[model samples]
Target chain A: MATFHFELVSPEKLLFSGEVDAVVAPGAEGVFTVLKDHAPVMTVLKPGVVEIDAAGNKEKLFVRGGFADVGLGGFTILAEYAIPVAELDAAKLDADIKNASEDVADAKGDEARRIAAEKLAQLQELKTALAL
Target chain B: MPSLKDLRNRISSVKATQKITKAMQMVAAAKLRRAQAAAEAARPYAERIEKVLANLAGGVSTGAPVLLSGNGRDETHLLVVATAERGLCGAFNSSIVRLAREHIQRLQGQGKTVKILCVGKKGYDQLRRNYEKNIIELVELRGVRQIGFDQGDAIGRKVIDLFERGEFDVATLFFSRFKSVIQQFPTALQLIPAQISANENEAAAGGALATYEYEPGQDEILATLLPRNISVQIFRALLENAASEQGARMSAMDNATRNAGDMIKKQTTLYNRSRQAIITKELIEIISGAEAL
Candidate 1:
């Protein structure tokens, strides 16, 4: 059986790197999976869940926006913010979402509003994943 | 002549100073170790990412994205100055700010419009006195709960926002690259145009080019990839700064401790000589009085 090496990294740290039979990432458009010898694909990752199937085990990660490169050896996901599902504190994340959402609504100017909105969107994605 | 109490007071002050500096050196040394570790750990990941990006970029055409395209005008320039959040890292912050100042002066002489964005508080505080008008943003991470991607993303978003608005033709990031505890170099890099080429032939470990497939197409991917690269690079700078700062602080405090020790030695020597001279005078007076009696 062939195994693909899957690695996820952020600027601060390397979140995960392991050999997996398959992996799925939420891309800019939608979710896509990569298997051994799957065609090399590169795309932007959206704020969503990334599920990795390694050695008959499944692991899920919540990532903020980033880039993913699926190449000859394996797949690499470069995320701005990548946290394991197990690490996600649902209560805290919910509070974060609520705060972020309120900040967006109360933002005075367009620039502040956009940044606030983006934060809200990312937190909301985490909320969805943790709720599941 | 100084009183014994004064001498004692001076001795205690010097001793206190020595203790403080010695303790600071020790603390800085520990932090420096952790900082160096973090910096070193980031290298492999950074190198791999750069390699992958470089390969993909090499395959893509020059006219693919604005980041890759580089508008062909160096008229307006944006300089992102990243420095340490705290002071006392001997010349670490000043050296970077100095380099940025020189760059700004040179650009101004050429009649180029320049804007500045400061990442750490120290840089902003230092440069703002002169470049207040040019400062577009100031992001201080001193109060940050943690150092992570979210901070980088926030900074990256600002840089991208400015770029998309066409505020500058080129953007440069100034930072100190950590080499060792005693050595750090201020680096000025072009962030815009995504000119940084990642490590070459790194992806070859997996075998041949192997025909890459684009999901949302290469062009769309590049558009986003280029922007994200800027933030990643900025984040890298912050981490490097964090490490370099600790290294600088450790070395600086070590030197300070040594200097303080030398100063205390010289003062003590002076005090001892003066006390000996006074004792000799008093002994002479007592001998002369006994002869008269």
Candidate 2:
């Protein structure tokens, strides 16, 4: 059997570690996938869900943007934030998103506003992904 | 000399304290595991960034990026001191700040201007008393429950802005690097002007070393790289600090608990000896009274 060494880690802890068939990541430019023989790459990740496939079993994870290192032997996904679907607290996350939205609205200047908005968007994306 | 009741109460309180310290030690041990993992996980990204910079910085002129430019000017310096938000970690935060204070004293003695950016509450709180005027900024982590890239990006952006404004020529960061439950070292590193000594590059794990290419020009890539590097460095420092704080606290609490147990044992032995002496005296007095009768 062929399997690619896979790991998904967040700052708090390693969320998942096992051999998986493939993985899909949200890159700065767009969505990217990694197979066993994928070329090496270094890029900034975007907030999205990472899908893992193993023996026809699938699992999804909600992640915030960070960086990913892909090589021939294996791939490691390092997201600024990562949480499994089973672990996501919807109500708490919703409240957080709402507060961030308000913060974005109250931001004073362009820079502050952009940072706040981006944060809100990231939280929103996380919530939406969790809903799935 | 305290009374027996006082001694008994003190023993019970010591026992209670031992229980608390033992519990805290267990909690810190558990948290240290997560913190250590986070710190170790950050190495690859940091190494990759350095590899890219090394490849791009290959014989590149010092004037290419302001970050790599060291005009041998030692007039002004920026010190970024990172510590934990809270305390009670066996002087982990103070150790880093103490090193920074020594650096600042030497820098001041040399007649160099100094600016400081404190990343955690503990550092700012401790350093502000003596160097408040020199503290340019404080990035408080009270609002953040966890460390992440967004915070890193924010800190990175702030540092880059300061550099762009010519606030300081050299930037240094002070932190504690985590190793195990009982050991850690206070690390002082130069952040700005990217001091990647050849020795450090050699020490980096070789298996992960690979050549990296910048799609854009080297200088342009460095413009982004240098700033991001600051934040990434801060992020790593924070992770390491977290682990180190937990490790130190764990060991400190374990020692405290053991000391408390030792105290309780000594007190109990004294109490038993005194009681035995009193019983012996009473028995002797009773036998003498019978003889007198």
Spell out the clash pairs found in candidate 1: A40-B213
**By summed lDDT, which 10 consecutive residues of candidate 1 chain B come out lowest?**
B198-207
Candidate 1, residues B1-293: lDDT per residue as tens digits? 78766877898798899899889889889887877777666665676667666766766655667787687888999999999888888999999999999999999999999999999999999999999999988888999633565677678878888887889989999999999889999999898877754443454444455477676777777666777678778878877888888889888888888988998898898788888888999999999999999
Once fitted onto the true fold, the runs of candidate 2 whose alpha carbons sit more than 4 angstroms away are: A1-132, B70-73, B142-145, B197-218
Indicate which candidate wins on DockQ.
1
Model 2 scores a C-alpha lDDT of 0.77
> Taking the candidates in order, what DockQ does each have?
0.53, 0.17
Tell me, by lDDT, which candidate is best. 1
Candidate 1: what's its TM-score on chain B?
0.92
Per-candidate clashes, comma-separated: 1, 0
Candidate 2 lDDT over residue span A1-132, tens digit each? 468888776644567778988888877567888788676665666667788887678888777666666755577776667776567677757776787889898877898798679778877876775563
